[model samples]
Target: MARFFTLEQAQQLVPEVRRMLNEAVEARAELEESQQEIAECMRKAHQMGGVDLDTGRLVLLRKRVDELGKKLKEILDQFEELGIQVKDLNIGLVDFPTKYRGEEVLICYQLNETGVGYWHGLDEGFRGRKRIDRDFLDHHEGDLVH
Candidate 1:
Protein backbone atom coordinates (compact mmCIF):
# COMPACT_ATOMS: atom_id res chain seq x y z
CA MET A 1 0.00 0.00 0.00
CA ALA A 2 1.09 3.54 -0.68
CA ARG A 3 2.12 5.64 2.28
CA PHE A 4 -0.53 7.94 3.69
CA PHE A 5 -0.33 10.99 5.92
CA THR A 6 -2.78 12.24 8.47
CA LEU A 7 -3.88 15.86 8.61
CA GLU A 8 -1.87 16.41 11.75
CA GLN A 9 1.15 14.68 10.31
CA ALA A 10 0.96 16.67 7.08
CA GLN A 11 0.68 19.95 8.94
CA GLN A 12 3.62 19.02 11.09
CA LEU A 13 5.75 18.50 7.99
CA VAL A 14 5.00 21.94 6.54
CA PRO A 15 8.20 23.62 7.63
CA GLU A 16 10.52 20.79 6.63
CA VAL A 17 8.65 20.16 3.42
CA ARG A 18 8.91 23.85 2.57
CA ARG A 19 12.66 23.69 2.98
CA MET A 20 12.91 20.59 0.82
CA LEU A 21 10.77 22.21 -1.85
CA ASN A 22 13.03 25.25 -1.97
CA GLU A 23 16.09 23.09 -2.47
CA ALA A 24 14.32 21.09 -5.18
CA VAL A 25 13.20 24.24 -6.95
CA GLU A 26 16.73 25.61 -6.99
CA ALA A 27 18.20 22.33 -8.16
CA ARG A 28 15.66 22.04 -10.96
CA ALA A 29 16.44 25.55 -12.12
CA GLU A 30 20.15 24.80 -12.23
CA LEU A 31 19.49 21.58 -14.13
CA GLU A 32 17.43 23.48 -16.68
CA GLU A 33 20.18 26.04 -17.13
CA SER A 34 22.69 23.27 -17.80
CA GLN A 35 20.36 21.70 -20.33
CA GLN A 36 19.91 25.00 -22.14
CA GLU A 37 23.67 25.52 -22.27
CA ILE A 38 24.11 22.08 -23.76
CA ALA A 39 21.41 22.73 -26.32
CA GLU A 40 23.06 25.98 -27.30
CA CYS A 41 26.36 24.16 -27.72
CA MET A 42 24.70 21.60 -29.97
CA ARG A 43 23.05 24.34 -32.01
CA LYS A 44 26.32 26.18 -32.46
CA ALA A 45 28.15 23.06 -33.48
CA HIS A 46 25.46 22.09 -36.00
CA GLN A 47 25.36 25.60 -37.39
CA MET A 48 29.12 25.71 -37.89
CA GLY A 49 29.39 22.41 -39.80
CA GLY A 50 29.13 18.70 -39.11
CA VAL A 51 29.26 17.98 -35.37
CA ASP A 52 32.74 17.92 -33.85
CA LEU A 53 33.06 14.82 -31.67
CA ASP A 54 36.21 16.01 -29.93
CA THR A 55 35.13 19.56 -29.03
CA GLY A 56 36.28 20.42 -25.51
CA ARG A 57 33.57 22.96 -24.70
CA LEU A 58 30.81 20.65 -25.90
CA VAL A 59 32.25 17.82 -23.83
CA LEU A 60 32.41 20.05 -20.77
CA LEU A 61 28.84 21.17 -21.27
CA ARG A 62 27.73 17.55 -21.57
CA LYS A 63 29.51 16.73 -18.33
CA ARG A 64 27.84 19.63 -16.53
CA VAL A 65 24.47 18.51 -17.84
CA ASP A 66 25.10 15.00 -16.53
CA GLU A 67 26.03 16.32 -13.11
CA LEU A 68 22.91 18.49 -12.95
CA GLY A 69 20.78 15.52 -13.97
CA LYS A 70 22.22 13.42 -11.18
CA LYS A 71 21.60 16.17 -8.67
CA LEU A 72 17.97 16.55 -9.73
CA LYS A 73 17.46 12.80 -9.60
CA GLU A 74 18.82 12.67 -6.08
CA ILE A 75 16.40 15.36 -4.94
CA LEU A 76 13.49 13.55 -6.56
CA ASP A 77 14.47 10.29 -4.97
CA GLN A 78 14.46 11.99 -1.61
CA PHE A 79 10.93 13.16 -2.18
CA GLU A 80 9.78 9.71 -3.20
CA GLU A 81 11.43 8.19 -0.18
CA LEU A 82 9.46 10.66 1.92
CA GLY A 83 6.25 9.56 0.15
CA ILE A 84 5.71 12.92 -1.45
CA GLN A 85 4.44 12.90 -5.00
CA VAL A 86 6.21 15.32 -7.32
CA LYS A 87 3.41 16.89 -9.28
CA ASP A 88 5.16 19.82 -10.94
CA LEU A 89 8.89 20.34 -10.97
CA ASN A 90 8.59 23.79 -12.57
CA ILE A 91 6.67 25.12 -9.57
CA GLY A 92 8.08 22.64 -7.10
CA LEU A 93 4.58 21.40 -6.46
CA VAL A 94 4.06 18.19 -4.50
CA ASP A 95 1.23 16.12 -3.10
CA PHE A 96 0.98 14.17 0.12
CA PRO A 97 -1.43 11.35 -0.35
CA THR A 98 -3.83 10.83 2.53
CA LYS A 99 -7.26 9.49 3.25
CA TYR A 100 -10.24 11.69 3.93
CA ARG A 101 -13.74 10.41 4.53
CA GLY A 102 -12.55 6.94 3.62
CA GLU A 103 -11.23 8.05 0.23
CA GLU A 104 -7.81 9.18 -0.91
CA VAL A 105 -6.97 12.79 -1.67
CA LEU A 106 -3.80 14.81 -1.78
CA ILE A 107 -2.61 17.61 0.42
CA CYS A 108 -1.07 19.99 -2.06
CA TYR A 109 1.93 22.15 -1.41
CA GLN A 110 3.74 24.49 -3.81
CA LEU A 111 7.05 26.28 -3.42
CA ASN A 112 5.44 29.72 -3.52
CA GLU A 113 2.99 28.84 -0.77
CA THR A 114 3.47 28.69 2.97
CA GLY A 115 1.84 25.74 4.65
CA VAL A 116 -0.34 23.07 3.11
CA GLY A 117 -3.76 24.63 2.66
CA TYR A 118 -5.27 22.87 -0.26
CA TRP A 119 -6.38 19.43 -1.31
CA HIS A 120 -7.78 17.62 -4.35
CA GLY A 121 -9.22 14.24 -5.19
CA LEU A 122 -7.15 11.38 -6.48
CA ASP A 123 -8.35 12.40 -9.93
CA GLU A 124 -7.79 16.10 -9.34
CA GLY A 125 -4.48 17.75 -10.09
CA PHE A 126 -3.16 21.19 -9.11
CA ARG A 127 -5.75 22.92 -11.22
CA GLY A 128 -8.38 21.41 -8.99
CA ARG A 129 -6.94 22.62 -5.72
CA LYS A 130 -9.57 23.51 -3.15
CA ARG A 131 -8.90 25.69 -0.18
CA ILE A 132 -8.60 23.69 3.02
CA ASP A 133 -10.67 24.66 6.02
CA ARG A 134 -8.71 26.81 8.42
CA ASP A 135 -10.71 25.32 11.25
CA PHE A 136 -9.70 21.81 10.41
CA LEU A 137 -6.05 22.71 10.05
CA ASP A 138 -5.86 24.70 13.22
CA HIS A 139 -7.58 22.29 15.57
CA HIS A 140 -7.53 18.97 13.74
CA GLU A 141 -10.75 18.23 15.62
CA GLY A 142 -13.25 16.10 13.76
CA ASP A 143 -11.07 16.39 10.67
CA LEU A 144 -10.40 13.30 8.62
CA VAL A 145 -7.53 11.05 9.62
CA HIS A 146 -5.70 8.20 7.96
Candidate 2:
Protein backbone atom coordinates (compact mmCIF):
# COMPACT_ATOMS: atom_id res chain seq x y z
CA MET A 1 0.00 0.00 0.00
CA ALA A 2 1.14 3.51 -0.69
CA ARG A 3 2.06 5.44 2.39
CA PHE A 4 0.61 8.94 2.50
CA PHE A 5 2.39 11.71 4.35
CA THR A 6 1.15 15.05 5.57
CA LEU A 7 3.17 18.10 4.69
CA GLU A 8 4.60 18.21 8.18
CA GLN A 9 5.44 14.55 8.08
CA ALA A 10 7.14 14.93 4.73
CA GLN A 11 9.08 17.90 5.95
CA GLN A 12 10.41 15.88 8.84
CA LEU A 13 11.90 13.33 6.49
CA VAL A 14 13.60 15.83 4.19
CA PRO A 15 16.98 15.73 5.91
CA GLU A 16 17.32 11.95 5.81
CA VAL A 17 15.95 11.73 2.28
CA ARG A 18 18.28 14.44 1.08
CA ARG A 19 21.28 12.54 2.37
CA MET A 20 20.21 9.29 0.72
CA LEU A 21 19.28 11.04 -2.53
CA ASN A 22 22.66 12.72 -2.70
CA GLU A 23 24.37 9.39 -2.14
CA ALA A 24 22.24 7.76 -4.79
CA VAL A 25 22.99 10.53 -7.28
CA GLU A 26 26.72 10.16 -6.68
CA ALA A 27 26.53 6.40 -7.12
CA ARG A 28 24.58 6.81 -10.34
CA ALA A 29 27.10 9.30 -11.68
CA GLU A 30 29.96 6.95 -10.85
CA LEU A 31 28.14 4.09 -12.51
CA GLU A 32 27.60 6.11 -15.67
CA GLU A 33 31.24 7.17 -15.68
CA SER A 34 32.35 3.56 -15.42
CA GLN A 35 30.03 2.54 -18.22
CA GLN A 36 31.28 5.34 -20.46
CA GLU A 37 34.89 4.37 -19.77
CA ILE A 38 34.10 0.75 -20.62
CA ALA A 39 32.43 1.85 -23.85
CA GLU A 40 35.46 3.92 -24.78
CA CYS A 41 37.73 0.98 -24.09
CA MET A 42 35.59 -1.27 -26.26
CA ARG A 43 35.57 1.30 -29.03
CA LYS A 44 39.33 1.52 -28.92
CA ALA A 45 39.68 -2.26 -28.92
CA HIS A 46 37.42 -2.55 -31.95
CA GLN A 47 39.31 0.14 -33.84
CA MET A 48 42.72 -1.40 -32.93
CA GLY A 49 41.66 -4.96 -33.83
CA GLY A 50 41.86 -5.94 -30.13
CA VAL A 51 45.64 -6.00 -30.38
CA ASP A 52 46.56 -3.90 -27.33
CA LEU A 53 43.44 -4.00 -25.14
CA ASP A 54 44.01 -4.11 -21.37
CA THR A 55 41.65 -6.90 -20.33
CA GLY A 56 42.54 -6.45 -16.68
CA ARG A 57 41.53 -2.77 -16.61
CA LEU A 58 38.33 -3.54 -18.47
CA VAL A 59 37.43 -6.23 -15.95
CA LEU A 60 38.08 -3.88 -13.04
CA LEU A 61 35.95 -1.16 -14.62
CA ARG A 62 33.08 -3.59 -15.19
CA LYS A 63 33.31 -4.73 -11.57
CA ARG A 64 33.18 -1.15 -10.33
CA VAL A 65 30.19 -0.47 -12.56
CA ASP A 66 28.37 -3.43 -11.08
CA GLU A 67 29.13 -2.29 -7.55
CA LEU A 68 27.95 1.24 -8.20
CA GLY A 69 24.75 -0.01 -9.86
CA LYS A 70 24.01 -2.14 -6.82
CA LYS A 71 24.62 0.79 -4.52
CA LEU A 72 22.19 2.98 -6.51
CA LYS A 73 19.57 0.26 -6.47
CA GLU A 74 19.86 -0.09 -2.70
CA ILE A 75 19.31 3.61 -2.23
CA LEU A 76 16.29 3.56 -4.55
CA ASP A 77 14.92 0.59 -2.66
CA GLN A 78 15.16 2.55 0.55
CA PHE A 79 13.02 5.27 -1.01
CA GLU A 80 10.49 2.70 -2.11
CA GLU A 81 10.31 1.23 1.36
CA LEU A 82 9.61 4.70 2.69
CA GLY A 83 6.92 5.45 0.07
CA ILE A 84 8.82 8.32 -1.42
CA GLN A 85 8.75 8.80 -5.19
CA VAL A 86 12.09 9.67 -6.78
CA LYS A 87 11.17 11.85 -9.72
CA ASP A 88 14.60 13.03 -10.95
CA LEU A 89 17.77 11.62 -9.48
CA ASN A 90 20.10 13.98 -11.32
CA ILE A 91 18.37 16.98 -9.77
CA GLY A 92 17.27 15.30 -6.54
CA LEU A 93 13.53 15.71 -7.09
CA VAL A 94 11.07 13.61 -5.09
CA ASP A 95 7.39 13.48 -4.22
CA PHE A 96 5.63 12.49 -1.06
CA PRO A 97 2.22 10.97 -1.68
CA THR A 98 -0.76 12.61 -0.11
CA LYS A 99 -4.43 13.30 -0.76
CA TYR A 100 -5.83 16.72 -1.38
CA ARG A 101 -9.56 17.25 -1.15
CA GLY A 102 -10.19 13.53 -1.39
CA GLU A 103 -7.97 13.17 -4.44
CA GLU A 104 -4.49 11.66 -4.59
CA VAL A 105 -1.71 14.18 -5.12
CA LEU A 106 1.94 14.66 -4.44
CA ILE A 107 3.85 16.88 -2.08
CA CYS A 108 6.84 17.70 -4.17
CA TYR A 109 10.33 18.55 -2.97
CA GLN A 110 13.52 19.37 -4.78
CA LEU A 111 17.05 19.36 -3.47
CA ASN A 112 18.01 22.56 -1.59
CA GLU A 113 14.41 23.77 -1.24
CA THR A 114 13.58 25.38 2.06
CA GLY A 115 10.90 22.82 2.89
CA VAL A 116 7.94 20.94 1.51
CA GLY A 117 5.97 23.89 0.17
CA TYR A 118 4.78 22.71 -3.21
CA TRP A 119 2.30 20.14 -4.44
CA HIS A 120 0.70 18.89 -7.64
CA GLY A 121 -1.75 16.36 -8.92
CA LEU A 122 -0.63 12.91 -10.00
CA ASP A 123 -0.75 13.90 -13.65
CA GLU A 124 0.38 17.48 -13.16
CA GLY A 125 3.97 16.60 -12.22
CA PHE A 126 6.61 19.19 -11.45
CA ARG A 127 5.53 21.62 -14.08
CA GLY A 128 2.11 21.96 -12.54
CA ARG A 129 3.25 22.28 -8.95
CA LYS A 130 1.48 24.91 -6.87
CA ARG A 131 2.70 26.51 -3.73
CA ILE A 132 1.16 25.23 -0.52
CA ASP A 133 -1.48 27.55 0.81
CA ARG A 134 -4.33 27.63 3.29
CA ASP A 135 -6.60 25.71 0.95
CA PHE A 136 -4.09 22.94 0.68
CA LEU A 137 -3.56 22.75 4.41
CA ASP A 138 -7.25 22.43 5.10
CA HIS A 139 -7.81 19.68 2.55
CA HIS A 140 -4.83 17.35 2.42
CA GLU A 141 -5.02 14.08 4.29
CA GLY A 142 -2.39 11.67 5.50
CA ASP A 143 -1.92 8.70 7.81
CA LEU A 144 -0.85 10.92 10.62
CA VAL A 145 -3.47 12.27 13.02
CA HIS A 146 -2.25 15.82 12.69
Return the clash pairs for model 1, or none.
Answer: none
Q: What is candidate 2's lDDT per residue for 1-146, written digit by digit as tens?
A: 88899988999999999899889989989998999999999999999999879999999999999899889999999999999999998899999999999988999999879789999999999999999999999999998422
lDDT of 1 by residue, 1-146 (tens): 47787666777877887787778778778878877877876777788785654478767877877887787788788888878898887887889887665667788888778678888888878888888876435532223333
lDDT of 1 at 143: 35
Shift of residue 76 alpha carbon in model 2, Å: 0.5
TM-score of each: 0.82, 0.96
Q: Where in model 1 is the C-alpha error above 4 Å?
A: 50-54, 134-146
